[model samples]
Target: MYQVIPPCMELRDHVSHFWFASWTAQQDRVQPVYYQTASCLAELAFAFRSSELVFASVQGHSPHAARYNAGGFLSIFGVSVFAYSLPLLFDVPPAALSGRFCTPEQLLGREGALLVEQVAGEADLPARVRCLNDFLKLRLRKAAEGDHRIIAAARQVMKPEVKFDLSAFAGECCLSPKQFERRFSACTGFSPKLFDRVSRFEYLLNNHRRFTTLTQAALASGYYDQSHFIRDFKQFAGCSPQRFFALSGY
Candidate 1:
C-alpha cells in the first residue's frame, strides 16, 4: 500500500511543497490480483512540490529493495532524513526526481559526513522536521526572494499537451541551449528534456485511476499515443501500469 502524508504547516511562498511519505503492504491484506499499464500506473502516485529528500529505514526485508523501484538508489545507509530543494535549485534536468539518487557530494556540493552522523544518531522526526524547516527557510531567504525565475519557467513548460523543446526554452531563457543546459544540470543534476518527460509521466500516473479508460488517461497526461506512453512507463516504473496498479493497492 502507498500512503502519502503532507506537511502539517503551510510553507512560505518560497517553499515549493513538501510531505512525509510511506508505503507498506501484506500479501493477504488486500486484493491479490490486478493489472494496469505502466502509463496507467503513472496516473496515481505521490507527487511532491519542492524537491524531496527522505530519510528512511526498513524493518523486515531489504528495505531498499522493498520500498523503491529500479531507479531508486541509496545515497547513504541508515535512517537519515534527506534534504530536497526544488529542481529550480538545479534548473530543469533530464529526469524527474522519482527513483533518482545521487552521491552526497553531488547533492550537498561539498564533502562532509555530518549528515551521516545525524542519521545514525537518535532522531526525533518531529523535532528534525522543525529544524529542517528552519534550515530551508534560511536558504530560501538568502536566495533571491519571490518565485525563482527558473522554477517559473519550468512550470510553464510542464504542460502535458506539449513536449519540452529545450532549444526553444533556451532561447526563451536568453541563453544558448548548451549554456542553459549547463546551468540546469548544475542545479538539478539531470537534463531538461528528461525532467519534462518524467514529471509529466508522473502527472499521468497520479491521475491514472481517476479517468474512465486507459486511453483517456494517456491523452490527458500528454502522451503522444498509447504505445509510446506504455513504452516509457515500463522503462521508468519497471512494470506495466496494470500490474503496478494492482500491486500499488496493497
Candidate 2:
C-alpha cells in the first residue's frame, strides 16, 4: 500500500496533502480511474497551493502506458500544458492533463526523473518532502511569490456568507485588474476568482460527511446561501452537496 509522510509545518504551505505507498510487483496494482496514476516501489507527490500546475516526475512509468513498471510519480495539476508528459489540468472546469504519458527515459533532466526511488528507504519521507519542498518554496519565493501569496490571501479572504470580490483582490495584489488577471492565469492556470471558488468547494468537501448537515457545511464553507452553495457545488463536484454527503458515508 502507498504510505505518505505527514507534512512539516513549513512545507504545508504548498502541499494540501502528501502520502507514499510501496507494493511488490504483484501487489502494486491500479484501477482504471481518472486523475490517478499507478506505480511500483512508487512514490507519489503533489502540490495544490495556487492554481499553478507545479508538480514533479522523479521516477516511474506513465499511467497511460505499461513500460518500466518500477514505479515513481511526479505530476503537476492544472490545465493541460500538452507536453510529452500527462498534463493534468485544474481550472474552471478541472480535467486530468493529457499527453503521451511518457516515462522516465524521456526526461530532459535525468536526476529529475530518477530521484523518487533513490531516496525511498531513507528513513524520512516527511523530512525529505519538506526539504525538497524548500526548493519549490524558493522557486515560489523568487517567481513572483504570487502563487503562494495568492492562495494564502484567498484563504484569509474567504468567510461564511460572504462573497469575495475579484476587482478588489486585483488591486490588493498591486497589479492592475488586467495585469492581475493575466499574471494569475500564467501562474495558476486559472483566474483568481475561479481558483478561490474551487478551493472553497474542495475545503468543504474534505470536511463533509454523513452527519455534516448541508446547511452547516455550506455555511462553514463560505456559501452565501443554500442555493448559492448548491449551484457552485454541483458545478465543481459533479453533484449537489446533499448527494455528495450521502455518498461520502463518513
Candidate 3:
C-alpha cells in the first residue's frame, strides 16, 4: 500500500509531500519496480527497520528509470522536496546529484546517519513522518533564504500551456542567460531547456486522461510533433506511451 501526507504548514513552501509505502513479498525472490524520473521534485527515502537512507535526484539529462527490489516485509518513508528547496536542506548542489542515487551519509554525513538511526528506531509511520518533519524544520532554521525570483521562474516553467523563452525569461528574472542557466541548473539539475521539456512531459502524463489521444495531449503540452513526444516519453518514462499507459492501467 502507498499513502501520502501533506507537508506541515511551515514546510509547505519547500516540501511537496511526505509519502509512505509498505509491501510484503509474495514469492521467495525480489520483485522489482521501476520509477520514472520526476522533473520538479527530489526524494529522500528511509528504509524502516534498516540503516538504509538514500537520496534520489530528480531525473535530469539521463533517461533511465530508477529500480528498487522488494522482498520480505518492506516499509519506506520519504519526503518529496520541491526542486528549488534541495539546496536549502542539503549542502550538495542539485547538479551534482543528477542521474544518481547516494547514501544519506554521502549527502548529509554524520547528520544523515543520525537521522537514519532515529527513523529506524520508530515503528509507526506517523511517528516516523513527524521525526522527519522535525529534522527538516531544523535544517530550514540554519539554511539561507530561498530566492523567490528563481522559485517563480521555476513555477513559470512548469505551466504546461506556456511557451518557455529562456533568454527572455532570464532577462525578466534580472539574470543574464548564462547566470540564469547556472542557478536554475543548480536548483533543478537540468538546464532551462531540458527542465522545460521534462516539466511538459510530466504535465502530459498526469493529465493525459482528460485528452482523447496521445497526439492531442502532446500538442497541448507543447510538443510540436508526435515523434518528439514519443522520444521524450521513452526517455523519461522508460517505455512508449501506449505501453506505459496500458501497463499502468491508466
Model number with the top lDDT: 3
Better of 1 and 3 by lDDT: 3
Local accuracy of candidate 2 as per-residue lDDT tens digits, 1-250: 4443544465344444455433333344653222222111122343222322234443321222122333333322111121111111112111222212323324424644544433332345455565455543453344432354455444444343456776887777777788777755454444557656755675575565532476787677777788888787776655655665465442
Candidate structures ordered by lDDT, highest first: 3, 1, 2
Off by over 4 Å in 3: 28-30, 49-63, 210-216
lDDT of 1 by residue, 56-158 (tens): 3211100011233312321222211111134222221323433344433344443213433343342444544454455444544554443344445556555
Point to the candidate with the largest TM-score: 3
TM-score of 2: 0.55
Q: Global lDDT for candidate 1?
A: 0.45
All candidates' lDDT scores? Answer: 0.45, 0.44, 0.76
**Global lDDT of model 2:** 0.44
TM-score of each: 0.57, 0.55, 0.84
Better of 1 and 2 by TM-score: 1
Clashing pairs in 3: none
Off by over 4 Å in 2: 1-6, 20-108, 119-162, 209-212, 245-250
